[model samples]
Target: MSAPTITFNGTIPQQYDDYLGPFLFEPYALDLADRIDYAPVTNVLELACGTGRLTNLLLERLPSSAQLTATDLNPDMMAVARKRTLAPNVTWAVVDISAIPYEDNQFDLIASQFGFMFVPDKLKALTEIHRVLAPGGKLIFNTWGAIQDNTAWAIVNKVLHAFLGGNPVPQHLGPFSMADAQVVLQALTEAGFHHVNATSVKKTGLAETAAIAAQGFIQGLPFATAIQEKDPSLLPKIQAAVEQEFSAQLGNHPLRTPLHALVFEASK
Candidate 1:
């Protein structure tokens, strides 16, 4: 049997969004927008626009003369994102990067934040991104750098696993790590990007050891369901264990997890 498809609104409880809200969109937008300073941008494309965090930043940096198109595979996510009053500079669409629906050479700049790792066929997605970029266009994007560096996830996953009696964690949920960076870069290179490099953008996790980090991943992602497959009633246990461990680790605030953002910028 297949798993039930998830929606952005239904993925996580509102409580989790409140918990994860501080880290959600603002920082990602600022950084991705900052990376494109090397060239003047006229038209832009953004992929996997989860709740419009990066989209917010892109609009701020884009000149009033420019236009931005933000796309995501999940319409529900896009629907939630559409709420922002984004300076009349953004066009929102539901699109799958694996088969990008755009004419060739349409964008001067294209990017995403925390989006690349989610693609089902990464090579196909890269090819499509490349296809849509105009000559001399740039690709600036990022993914989770390493699991150990992200204390919020590391602690959450660890405690949840212990509650589940030490079951192995699935690879997809913790997809980006140091070991995977080389292959990720290679895939981008194979997809025809030149001058590829991954940069370190680290943030200290503010949530403490005991506080439930937020609703974002604990409730928002399909990962918890994956864990549930091992045990029919793991969801409640996972939630409880994560809450207890986080509370044990954090007393009244968010933990200070050192997170890294592995960034790559290159040209076609």
Candidate 2:
């Protein structure tokens, strides 16, 4: 499947950081950060570091001597990230994972959260990630599991597809495209990574209310742009449908739903 072109410019980045961060990303950020063996990692590289949710946690965990290079494909996203995470040891850059702008064998740790699935050339990105890691360095990242496994998003996807009259929705599917653990492991091995491991992790995704959750699902992602392009007038209806569905399946008043993801760890 072709990768969806999702623009992170304009107010989308802010909405993403404000609304989606706590609801969907923060829990996984904590999980990714805790999996790191930070003692030996003096130089770190974070790929697709959107809004610095994990960056902030990495800064807190890493030793003061370590430096973090947090990067994303979108500068607008990095702009929000820079404002959210501040540390002399952390440097922000606009970097495409397919073509990482860094020297080989430079970093002791390379990490990403919910970002790898969006890469169009998974092999090239994995190869680059392996090439840039120091010998014995670790690579850790996570991707959302199947859409059906992530209840809230599954509901949102169903609503979106129905609104679009059962048309193929590539934008919403990109994030969960690499859900299979074996597929990710095979790519990592082909990229020259060893001791590769994949784990299934499930966490609770939270939102203050179903309406707020629906708003984030509709407006806080690139899917919002797709909706706007398809029919700007349908946006409100779509949001309301998602909200109603969320309340029926998962209640409001601090809405919580199970989020499933696959975590991969490998050695270079």
Candidate 3:
């Protein structure tokens, strides 16, 4: 007999939020903040604010009276974000980056964390972001750099891919399509953002064990949602297989995942 499994699983686990925030959020704060000349800043906006990690950071960095707006396309995630939110000064909005509701030049600084890639139309979203920024205002965003150098996620993905036979894919997204430098630059340039730059940064973190790391990836972004329609009975096999692979190599010990990220900062 074998363990029952799911081919298309959509269940988000309990520890996901905790793991995601530290692994991704806290480290990217400084990168996001440096884009703007905060000297005269009065208003700020963030798109794709996952669980308010970066949103809260911007709030903390803002002047006493500075106003900040944070938005997310996922209401569920945003709701979770609101609970852990430390900044009362932030006005969280449920928004689509491609079609921002605010007036043009309404913001002094526009920022995001890992949100630029999911947008359906990069150029439309960029123009909208610029439209809402005052002249000389800036846009700061981040994306996953590349797979080989993304240590933590790489291990997780390798396990899942190996589990699901091989080359597990969702729709047409190849592993690196969204994060490729050329695509990012093109989108920014066409969106009217100048001084475009993309650079890889070092990212590192510790997960207590291989299983925890695997679970985190299983429950996290893009991957879980992307595979939700593949089938309804193969998920457990995938999970089990990955966990076995991880345990065999790295057991229940602390795992440090060194990551690589691409930061893009530009002006409107």
Segments of candidate 1 deviating more than 4 angstroms: 1-17, 163-174, 177-179, 208-214, 224-234
Q: Residues 1-268, candidate 2, lDDT per residue (tens digit)?
A: 2334766777788888888899999999999999888898899999999888999999999999999999999898899889876589998888989898899999999999988877778899999999999999999999988878899988987887788754234643378888888988999999999999999999989899998888887788887777777778998998899999999999989898999999999998
lDDT of 2: 0.87
Best by lDDT: 2
List the candidates' TM-scores in order: 0.84, 0.96, 0.84
Error of 1 at 185 (Å): 2.3
Clashes of each: 18, 0, 8
Per-candidate local distance difference test = 0.69, 0.87, 0.69
lDDT of 3 at 95: 94
Please give the lDDT score at residue 144 for candidate 1.
Answer: 79
> What is the lDDT for 16 in model 2?
88
Tens digits of per-residue lDDT, candidate 3, 141-241, equal 88777877775556667766654544454312343446688888888898788888887778676667766666666665545543444664665566566
List, residue by residue over 62-95, the lDDT tens digit for candidate 1: 7888989999887767766777654777898988
Candidate 3 wrong stretches, greater than 4 Å: 1-15, 34-37, 165-175, 225-233, 247-252
Worst 10 residues of 3 by lDDT: 1-10
- Model 1 residue 261 CA deviation (Å) reads 1.8
Tell how far residue 204 is off in model 3, in angstroms.
1.5
